[model samples]
Target: MPKAILKLYLILKRERFDIVQYSTTNAVFYAATASWLACIPVRLYAQWGIRYVVFSGLVKIIFKQIERWCCRCSTVIEPDSMGNLEFSIREGLYPRDKGRVIWNGSACGINIERFDISQKDIWRTEYREKIGCDVHHLVVGFVGSIRADKGCNELIAACRSFFSNMPMARLLLIGDKVFYSTIDKDLRDWVESSDQVIHVPPNDQIPQYMACMDVFALPSYREGFGMVIIEAEAMGVSVVASNVPGPADAIRHEVTGLMVPVRDAVALAEALQVLLRDPAKRTAYGVAAAAFARDSFEQKKFLQYVLADKEQLIAEEEFQINHAGKHV
Candidate 1:
């Protein structure tokens, strides 16, 4: 890895590159090491979150050391949110002064104007009719990958419990399965046999489906600022999510949506029941959620912060290069 990085750095250096931007932890480590070896001083690292470190064992400790080394080599380390910045500080991975937060969590959010509910009535009707989720059935939806870490299993359990009480409610699941074979047989049977549960394949029509649902649900065990939460909110769908870091940061409890503990199927079911029974409350939450997402997680604000951070990192790197040149 070191040798290949050094070779690539020599090639890029000869090409006269002005700024170096690195994404992901492994790439940042290699880029920082290669830049130091090649005497190219302009280096910047972008972090979504420390996933490997938080997920793995001894490797996580090593990742922390590697991150510290990369942080020292790079001119700046840009994190996606204040929540991530706090995590880095608590983990002792990077100095607080070295980290910068880009606005609105995601690097780029969904195009809000394109997902307007007014333009989606036909699609909504088609979705409703196709899934047998008419006006009589209150639909609760889930979007994103079907993984245990994403709490898809918990969602299924919650839906089973929710449907037992509110038989008229429907579960709308959107996204491709991450490991279809690994899922429990009983759970698969339940999803297929249950008339109330409808599984949609991953498609470009996410916005249309989101608009059709009364409430959007995701009870993830881990997330580094989920873009889907903002997407659902922008489509005027009320959300019910796990009380984890990213979801908690995105959702305002009872105002925009309800939040339950991670992996609490009963709590998720109860929350679903609340939205299912009360049509007026659901609409109120949907309107409030849409307004909140537009004001907070819009794409324009995110782009502005990312661009500014990039420029500032470049300028600092240039200053370091000039200072080193004077000493030589």
Candidate 2:
């Protein structure tokens, strides 16, 4: 690790970088260490999420210490969500003043133009028919890795409950199941056995798949920020997400969509049932969610915020250099 840091420091020193940004835990530690050693003018650590939150024992302690060191070494810590920022501060991973959230809080916001509702009907027909599901059926969509921490078991349970009550309801699981080996065997068995459950491999046409759905579900145990929630919203789809930090930040309970307790299959099922049964309420929530997403999580607005931050940082660096020159 020391040798790697030394090599990185040499590169940074030679390059004379004005800004050094690191993402993920490993990159943050190594890059921040090198940047600090190289005396980079602007050191940034993007805290997308914390993986060690789910761990225990000495492992958790060691990871926490590493995160803290990275945070201390960086000039700025930008967490993708307010909830995550608060969590980091509470855990003493970083000081509150050093951190700031971008826009409403997503790594990159949704492209409202691409995920347009105008194409919803077209894509809905195309995908639904492909899956042999009629237009009247309520498709509860999920787009992400199929894994344990993502609440796949809870989602399957919720779907089972929902399907029992409403046979017209279908589950659309879209992602690379092959890569996510942590998926429960029961969930896999249910998907394979049930005709109503459609497990499509991950594809580029996420917007089309999202449009086919009347509602989206992301019952993740934890997230830095739930970008897909806003993406689904941008497509005029109501969401039922876990009441964890990331999803909570994106969803406004009862207004935009619904929020259930983390890993609570029964509560998730109830939320899905409510949306599926009440078409008027579902449409209202979807409309409000679309408006909220466009106003808050648009891609253009997100980029502007990021560019503005970079400009400010550059200005500060210039001011410091000028002051140092005057002092000399």
- The runs of at least 3 residues in candidate 2 whose Cα sits more than 4 Å from the true structure, single-residue gaps closed, are none
Give per-model TM-scores.
0.87, 0.96
Best-performing candidate as measured by lDDT: 2
lDDT of 2 by residue, 61-155 (tens): 89888888898999999999999999998998888889999878999888988898889888989978987788789999999998878888899
- Model 2 has an lDDT value of 0.89
Per-residue lDDT tens digits for candidate 1, residues 1-328, read: 6677878678767866666767776777777777766666566677765665345778867777887788778766766656667777787767888777676676475577777766566777887887777777788898887767777777888888658877788889898886754456777789889888888989988888887898899898766666788888888888999887667777889998999998888898888888888889988998898898888877867677768877876788778779999999
**Where does candidate 1 stray beyond 4 Å?**
2-7, 25-36, 53-56, 59-73, 319-328
